[model samples]
Target: MQRNAFMLLMDEPRSTLDPIATAQVDELIDELRQNYLVAVVTHAMHQAARVSQKTAFLHLGNLVEYGETGTVFANPTDPRTESYITGRIG
Candidate 1:
């Protein structure tokens, strides 16, 4: 007998991969999401928005906000979150 319940935690899984490898990993991540909870930590906003159903915006090691990815990205409640997302802070 085998246990099937799982959670996949990927921390910068694509950080060192080339474009081809990145795409492969992305596909694997998407596929795994069907059967497991996938938690990814990435600086790539596009990837975050694409793969995650929920998003958390953290600043200076503090959780500034957390909510639906589209809502958070489109209309962030916190000024700091907005500043970082829109390239105003960096």
Candidate 2:
């Protein structure tokens, strides 16, 4: 069988995955990003930290911050970003 959705922008496909399998898909997305452009919508900050070299913070449909992952995580220019990273606020 094929590995994953390289570009799932068209056609209806059944999501026949259990919780464990779904998690695997997330991991695969992170790995596939090394060779392809991947856009992942996730709420887990740590997950973004693991998969992305760049992190973008979106609050209320507005782009609040965008930059290097390490720089943003370690020192965010936006107060919201800082709070999100430090687990103080989100």
Model 2: lDDT equals: 0.69
**Count of backbone collisions in candidate 1:** 0
TM-score for each model: 0.83, 0.66
- CA error at residue 25 for candidate 1, angstroms: 1.9
In terms of lDDT, the best-performing candidate is 1
Can you write out model 2's per-residue Cα lDDT over 39-83, one digit (the tens) per residue? Answer: 656666666676668778888899999999888888899998888
**Residue 23, model 1, lDDT:** 82
Write model 1 residue lDDT over 1-90, tens digit each, in one string: 137758888898889788788788889889989988898998877778877899998778899999999998999999998988888886
- Give the 10-residue window scoring lowest on summed lDDT in candidate 2: 7-16
- The segments of candidate 2 whose C-alpha lies over 4 angstroms from its true place after superposition are 1-27
Each prediction's whole-model lDDT (CA): 0.86, 0.69
Clashes of 2: 0
